[model samples]
Target: MMQPILTVAEVNGYIEEVFPEVQGQYLCEHIAPMEARVRAVVGPQNLRPGGTVSGPTMFGLADCGFYMVLLAMIGKQALAVTTNASIDFMRKPEPCDMIAEARILKLGRVLAVGDVLMYSEGSDKPVARASMTYSIPPAR
Candidate 1:
């Protein structure tokens, strides 16, 4: 059976209950019908000068996206911590919203890794790429 993905409503509830700031920064969307992966989008408030999305904006989205994904798969656990993050800014994103697609690369007892590709909304090219490592606390 395929794993279930978190719905936009569920994501919002999570934000309201734990990560309130994420609700305004990112919107969880259903990108594909078959894969059930989540796509997080950033709104205008996250923009920087020159009409491009800022690095910290993308990082926040990436970080929050991982947290959402992990909660979708393993259930909400607020203690998960971001242990490592390496991102490359390839190009300036267009003057619009930013999108990030995150998928888990590995999930073990203590660590979870995921890759995030960031792009400017309405653009076909990627603006950045990031890999994040999250440390999931041991089960109680």
Candidate 2:
């Protein structure tokens, strides 16, 4: 297994520094070879009319979790952007914090593919799953 280029705390700090607008909402809890664990605190803005977590909110969390795992493996490539993403909403997420566990399926020179499973806080069942691909920019 390859060593992570960034620690969980480092990735969290990077997100805070680069995406301050989302600071305090998303957190990188753990990071390893090609995986990362992240959490998104559910706020009023993330809740829908039915008192459930919105699909867009879960999608955002999944995308960010995948990106953080990629960054942990490849270091800070701010240009490493999501090229495509497909998310399936399984169960209705509770109006609480959501946890995302992301794993990289492939890490090629130009592209990275990953999947994320999101669960509502304290629940063992997954509420959403996302498959995503990212375009990794060439090294400068």
Q: Against the unseen true structure, what C-alpha lDDT does each candidate score?
A: 0.71, 0.94
Q: Note the residue pairs that clash in candidate 1.
A: none
Deviation in angstroms for 79 in model 2?
Answer: 0.7
Cα RMSD for candidates in order: 2.8, 0.7
* Candidate 2 C-alpha lDDT tens digits along 1-140: 77899998889988898889999888999988999999998999999999999998998999999999999999988889999999999999999999999999999999999899999999999999999999999988
- Candidate 2: the clashing residue pairs are none
